[model samples]
Target: MRFQIDPNDRKPLGRTGETVPAIGIGTWRINNYSMAETALIRAIEVGMNLIDTAEMYANGEAEKLVGRVCRIIGRDRVFIVTKILPDRFSDQSKVIKALEASLRRLGTSYVDLVLIHWPRPGISIEKQIQFLEATVEAGMARFIGVSNFGVENLSRAIRATKKHEIVANQVKYSVLDKQVEKDLLGFSIENKILIQAYTPLEWGGVAKNETVISIAKKYGKTPIQVALNYLISRPMVMAIPKTERVERVEEFRGSMGWRLGAEDIEILEKI
Candidate 1:
């Protein structure tokens, strides 16, 4: 009910100096098409315009739904991010085609950001980065990044870039998972790369956590809001939590424009 913000509320999107909402919505395992579309429309209306989808999600059904949402809400109002499967990395032409197919599904000529779903074995990181780089040059994507890349691979990927910078790293980061803090977070901060925190609620695992629930009471927020606030409060980090409820998107607004105290952050880190 409190801590509501303007729809234009934004955070630094890496060192590119561009800004995106501190909280974005993720479309991963969405099944109820109509319900999900309504929630996505609410997300964009409330300023969480970055919609993350992949051609692999629900066998490409997610992108089609996102396309419908874009058509309803106007594609320019949404910053769509999509991914190409690692198997497409084998050939430059395949990589281009993968993004082209994604564009077709999304009903857009280009995505705000495109990434490789994951690193494939036997295929060099150099080649994968090159493929992502090609998407940008081809005008299929505005910016390029990687998903699930660790510090070592991320370092190598950034080095492999020839024309553009790796602006973000979409990774599984949440209070339940502190693995990103070990090294990847630091590397991203030092290089000015955005850390897209997916599964920020630990896939609903935080709902009953006493620690998060207790903190939620302190801020008059829900457990889910506490879970997301904890992630976006960090530097160069944004949370892309998936939800199919319009009410849930409303709850997400409280997660921004506020933060936990140092003591609470320390307590959460121990969780």
Candidate 2:
């Protein structure tokens, strides 16, 4: 399929003016640390411009692998995204320290987006936003957001950080779990906070679904392509599908070009 920048709403991840691919490549499960750099190289060669990782993923090995690949290719070509653990919120210095560690591990000076991994219980929301604002001011990250935040938490974050822009919310989005659809999805679209889908493949479950298989056959595509296409069709939504094989990366890239028909979209809606 054709690969190019999609014509969807290219909202800013924050005020950094860096626009990303509506579909990204998430490096969460490709856990062979020995081959992580090779996997990253394969991803970049195939056309994945967005790479999502986290400080906690493999105890930071993922970042190190991504760093090596980025250094070899030049950082300008890839949009690197990672999140900070919520427990570190009370101490703003920990936020900076964690980021510095991530930077050192990734061998990069700045990250495209840094999200609060999750909204931990008992921590003041104000402290979270304060650390994020301070993070941006210190140039540790360009944009800030939260992951796994509900509508109420998202609203609270927005309200708490009215002075600082909250760009997006990274959450567990897939055909199987549409909790965000209840309200978080619609609210985020209206508020200009892009919804970044983490496990766009249904966590390996979509591959066996008959409906997805049938749709893929009709489109002459793979099941993963259909699932990813469905997610990308929605406004302000991006899918980050993780895979190690070059062919699989190409398949994820394949989902970006064609527009799913209305009937097909409706069919996938029930999925």
Candidate 3:
């Protein structure tokens, strides 16, 4: 299927009636408190208040840094989303317990969203979704979803839910990696599940692309900014790019408040 986004129309969080910046902070590889502290503050100043973290990231040390940054920035100003590791999915059900640990690390009582880190072997989609439903029921998670889920797994996971709806799916999507665009992207758009794009820059690969560079020059924007904005051009999509540098956060902010031209998008489509 071919995609043609207007690029000018700003899509919301998959019809959730919530308003947040199209880009957000990703604390995946950040382990330093001071660097994350400065970076997150700058992120908020530029309207990127969403923060994505996982208990598995740096063995929960990254959540501690995000927790500290949230404290400094005032928690209400930011939308926090954290993932629960797959090992917690089982009959014994350590899911709620794990989310609590993440909450303790995040220094918050309730997170904006909670996701199953990834689908696990021998774990029923029913069980996985049930565990996440428990988090929302306990008032600890405002929404529940999954990450690294393909279309088949995502469909099964959603069907397994009983009480709450699956809200978002965090995936590795970038200009260089368009795997999700094949089927998952279209499905998520139809189902109103927001696709939270991780690694949207392909670790700086887009910066070296001649086409992306030329488009950047036309807009007076950095290649990174063009790449990030390109991801958000899709329906029900947003980006969460991780950076340890404060200046990078400022640069990331430039990705929004503008749209890429359709002609440029056509060239990017070829890429």
TM-scores, in order shown?
A: 0.95, 0.92, 0.95
Candidates ranked, most accurate by TM-score first? 1, 3, 2
* Best candidate according to lDDT: 1
Candidate 2 lDDT over 1-271, as tens digits, reads: 1122234634346444556677777878675655656666777776667789999988898888789888898898778889888878768889899999999998989998888999978888877887888888988787788898888888888888845688888888876666767787778767878889888887778878898899899999988888888777776688888876666777787887777777777776676
Residues 1-271 of candidate 3: C-alpha lDDT, one tens digit per residue: 2665635324465456765567888987665668778988888767788889899999889888878888888999878999988888875348878988999999999999899899978988888898889888899988888999999999998788897888889999998788998999999988988889999987778899998899999999999999988898887888999887898998888787778878887788778
- For model 2, the superposed segments whose C-alpha errors exceed 4 Å read 1-17
- Each model's lDDT: 0.87, 0.79, 0.85
Displacement of the residue 49 alpha carbon in candidate 1, Å:
0.3
Put the candidates in lDDT order, highest first: 1, 3, 2
Of 2 and 3, the candidate ranking higher by lDDT: 3
With candidate 1 superimposed using the best TM-score fit, by how many Å does residue 257's alpha carbon deviate from the native?
1.5
| Worst 10 contiguous positions by lDDT, candidate 3 | 6-15
So what's the TM-score on candidate 1? Answer: 0.95
Any idea what lDDT model 1 has? 0.87
For model 3 the local lDDT of residue 146 reads: 92
